[model samples]
Target: MTDDTTIEIEEVGGHRVDADRLRDLLTENARIREIFADSDVAGLRVLGPQVPVRDQDGPPFTATVVDATGNVAATVRGDLDRPDAFEVASTAVVPNPTHEELRGALEVLHADERYAPFAGRDDVIVYQPMPPTSDVEQDDGTVVRRITLGIFDPDGSPVHRFVAVDLRDRLVDWDLHGVEHLDDHDCEDHLPVGVGGLPGGDTGLGQVRVRVVKGGQELWSFTVVRPRDSAPTHLGKGSGVELRQVRYRGRLVLWQAHVPILNVLYDDGVTYRDWQNSETQFQAVGSDPVGPGWRVCSGPPATILESGTDVGNFQGVAFWYDDGELQIVSEMQAGWYRYISEWRLRDDGTIQPRFGFAGTRNPRTCMRHQHHVYWRLDFDIEGAGRDIIEQRGLILPGQPVWHRIVRETKRIRSPFAREWRVLDADSGRGYRITPGAADSSADAYGVADLWFLRYRGTELDDGVGVVGGPPSATQVKLDQYLTGESIDRTDVVVWYAGHFLHDEEHPSPHQGHVVGPELRPVRW
Candidate 1:
C-alpha cells in the first residue's frame, strides 16, 4: 500500500515443485557433466521452465542451467525426444561471468604491476559493461571477455582507464579517461528506496504468502515467488515476482501477475534486464562507467550508508501496512539497479501497483536511459471464463471513445488512446488501468508498451534473450507471441510495460523514480 492503516504480515509453508531436487538431477547428468569439461562447477544457476499452474504437484519442467563460473549453460528437461525419459541439452551455451568469476577477473588485473596501486583490495567492483557492448564479444579461437572494475580512492587512484587483457597476458590493451577518483562519500546519503535481493540467497525455492486486510475485511491475497536469475526470458521460465491467486476483497481479479522481464535501454544503446547479472547479495553492480571505463565496487560504494540494510526472512513471507494502504512488496537487484515489486490495495478496493528503479553507485548513474518493466497480468475477472478487453481513446466531441480489443496483438500507448479495461463479458465487472505519468512510449530498443494476448500456457514471456547472446537476443521479440489467437471472449493475459526514464539532467532525481499503473475498480 502506498499510504496505509493497520496491517499484518506473516509467512506460511508452501512448495509448488521440488526445483532444487530437479536441478540436482540436471547437474548430475552424464552428458551435461561432459559439457562443463570438469570446470570447478563452483556455482550454478538454473531458471525453471514455464510452470503455468502455480499449484499441482510435479509437472514436468525444462530448466535452463547456467554454469557462470565454468562459462557454459544448457537446458534440462524431464521428458525429452529420447527414450531415456530426459535430455540434458542439445548444445552448450556460454554464460557471462559469475559473482565469483567477476572476482577472478579482479585477480587477473592484480597480477599486473601497472594495476599495483589498488592491489589486494576486496572492495573492487566488477561487472560486464552494459548492453550491445556487454553482448559484443569475439568468438574467435581466442574468446574475448571484456570486463570493467574500479573503486573510488580519495588519494586519486589510477582507476579511470579501459583495459582489455587477454587471459594469456599477451594482449593487454588500455585506453585511459582521466576522471578524478575522489575518496569521498558525497553521494552516499542519496541511496534510493527499495534495494533488490532483499533477504537474498537461493531465490528459486523462495516463496512468501501474504494476506491484506483493512478494518476487518480481506482486501488482497497472494504468494510471492522470489524467482531465480535467468539467462534471458527466452531460455528460462521462472523469474521475477510471481503473484498467485490474486484476489480483491472477496472476489478474484488476476489469477496471477508477475514481471516476466524488465528491459533498460541506455542512451549508448546498451540493454539490460532483471535476469542479467542479477544481484544475489546486499550490493548489485552499477551501470555506466564512473570515470573512464572503470569503477569497481561489488555492491554499492562503502560510503553509501543505507545500501547495506539487512534483508530479513531466512525462508518465509512477511508484510506490514503503511500510510493508508496495504502494501506487499519484494525486491531484486539486477546489476547496479534494484527492482521493487510492490502491490498496494486500499480499503476501497483500489489497487496501485508499482515497480521502482533505484541505483547504488556508478559512473552511468548520470547517463540517460529508460527502464521498462513488462508485467504478465493473467486476468480471471469474476472467474476464468470468456472475458473481454477494451481500450479508451481520446475524447471525441463530448465523449471518450472506447474500442474493445478484438484480436491477440501488441499495443502502444498514446495521448489519444491512453487507458484499457478487461472484464467478464456476461457480468460486465472489471478494472480500468491508468498509466503512470512517467510511463513513456516505445524507444528504439523497447519495441512497444503493452501486449494484450489470449492466455496460452507457452506464452508466459516475450522470451527475449538477455545474457549477452546474439544481436537478435537483445530485442523484446514479443511479436513472435502474436501469431493470431482470438481474445474476443476468452480468458486473457494483459502484458503491461511501465516505461520510466532515468535522466541525471531534468526531473529532480532526489524526489525518487518509480513507475507503474493504478488499477481502479471499474464496476462491481
Candidate 2:
C-alpha cells in the first residue's frame, strides 16, 4: 500500500474522534475484525477525519466509516462504538465540498432543532456574512475554508449567537445559541452607506479640512492658499476661534455673520421686512460663513435689481439680477433688544455691509447708550501689492453754492471721511469704501469713515463697545500698523467704523432700525 492510501473516519454526534484513539478502538472491536477479516489491512496509516454529511430523515447520530486501507466499510447508523457499525463496502472516494454547498449546509443546521429558537421571528434582521478566512493549503494543494456570521436582535442590539462553518468538509462546526452577548461593533462595517446611524452631509464650505470634536464646532482658518510660480504661497493658520453659537452670560448668542436669513427683498410696493409678495428673494450658497468665524445665510439666487424701459409698446432694455447677502442677529435680555447686521453682495461685485440696533428697551434700565460698530476688511486685489489710496470728495468752499471736488492720492495717516478708494493699477480693480446710512452721530468719535494700513498679523477690531469709551489696546495696535508703510503697492487692510446712538427718551419704534456702510467696486 502507498503512504497516501490511508483510512479516514467521518465525525459522528457532532464530534470527531482522535485518529490514534479511533485506531486503538477499531483494533480492539470484534465487529471491525469480522468486516476486514478477508482483506490485508495490517500496517495501515490513518488520515484526518472528514465531516459527516447529514441525512434528511436518518437518526441524528449516524455517520459513515472507512477502513485503514482507504475503503468504505459500512454506514454507522446506530449507537454502537460508532466505528463498530461499519460493514465492508467497495468505494473509498469522498469529494470535498465547495463554499456555496457548505454555506447551504450551515443554513440547514441553523433551521434544525439545535437552533430552533431563532429559526423565525419578526423584527430580527440578519446581515450577510463577512468574507471567508484566508485559504489554508494542504500538502496536496487542497484548500480549507471557514466562515462565521452573527445573529442579532433589537433588544440590547448586541450579537449573542454565531454560526461557524467548516467549508472544506461541508459541515456546521457549531451553531452557538444562548451565549453571552458580545459587543459586535464590527457588524456596523457590513451596513450600507447612508443607511447606518452615521452623520451624513452636515458640513459647511471653507470647512473642507477641519478637526472636529463632538458637541461644538470651531473656526480653524479662513484663508485658502493658492501659490503662484514666483510668489510665496500664503500658508493658512487658523483664526483659533469657535465658529458656532457663542456663549455670552450663559445664553447662546450668534454673531451678525452667523445668522441665517433666507432673503432680503426691495419690492415696488412692499416693505423690506415684508415676507409675503416681496419682489426680490436672495438665495443662500450653502452654510459657509460670510465672514471669519461666523455662519452666514445662503440659499436661492439673489434678485439684485430689475428695470425695464419701453417706447410705446416696444420694449427697450431689460435688467435682471444675481447677488448674495449675509444677515445675522443677536437677542439681548430675552428678546428685549435685537442687534442685526446685514451685508449685501451687489450685482456689480461690490459689498454693502451694515448693522442695526433695534427692538424694545428693557423697562428696568432705560439708561441712554450708543452702539459703535466697526468692520475689518482685508483686501487681496490683484495679488496684494502696489496699491494707492485716493481720497476724493465734493467740498463747498465757505458756504458758496458751487462745490469743489477735492481728490488726494496718498496714504491715510489719520482717520477721516473723504470717499476713499484703494486702487491697484496692475489689476485695475479698486474698492470705494464709504459709510452707509446713519442716524445722527456717525462720526462722533473723530475716527475717519475708513482707515487703511499695511497687512499685519494681529490687527482686528469690529468696533463693538461703549459709545464714549476709549479705544481698546487692540484699536491702538491697529493705529500702530498705519504709522506709514509705503501703501503705494503693498498688501493692505481697511477698517470701516459706523455707529448708532440710542437714548431711552427717544426709544426705537415698533419696527426697528438699520445702519452701516456701502462699498462699491471702482474701475473693476
lDDT (CA) for every model shown? Answer: 0.56, 0.33
Q: With candidate 1 superimposed using the best TM-score fit, by how many Å does residue 386's alpha carbon deviate from the native?
A: 1.7
**Sequence-dependent TM-score of model 2:** 0.35
lDDT of 2 at 61: 34
Candidate maximizing TM-score: 1
Candidate 1: deviation at residue 476, Å?
Answer: 1.4
Q: Write the per-residue lDDT of candidate 2 for residues 228-260, one digit (tens) a residue.
A: 100000010111111221222122111111111
Task: Give me the runs in candidate 1 sitting further than 4 Å from their true place.
Answer: 1-10, 13-45, 54-59, 67-70, 79-83, 87-115, 119-148, 154-205, 227-240, 276-318, 397-400, 469-472, 507-512
Q: Could you say which candidate leads in lDDT?
A: 1
Residue 515 lDDT, candidate 2, scale 0-100: 60
RMSD of 1: 8.3
Q: How close is candidate 1 to the true structure, as a TM-score?
A: 0.74
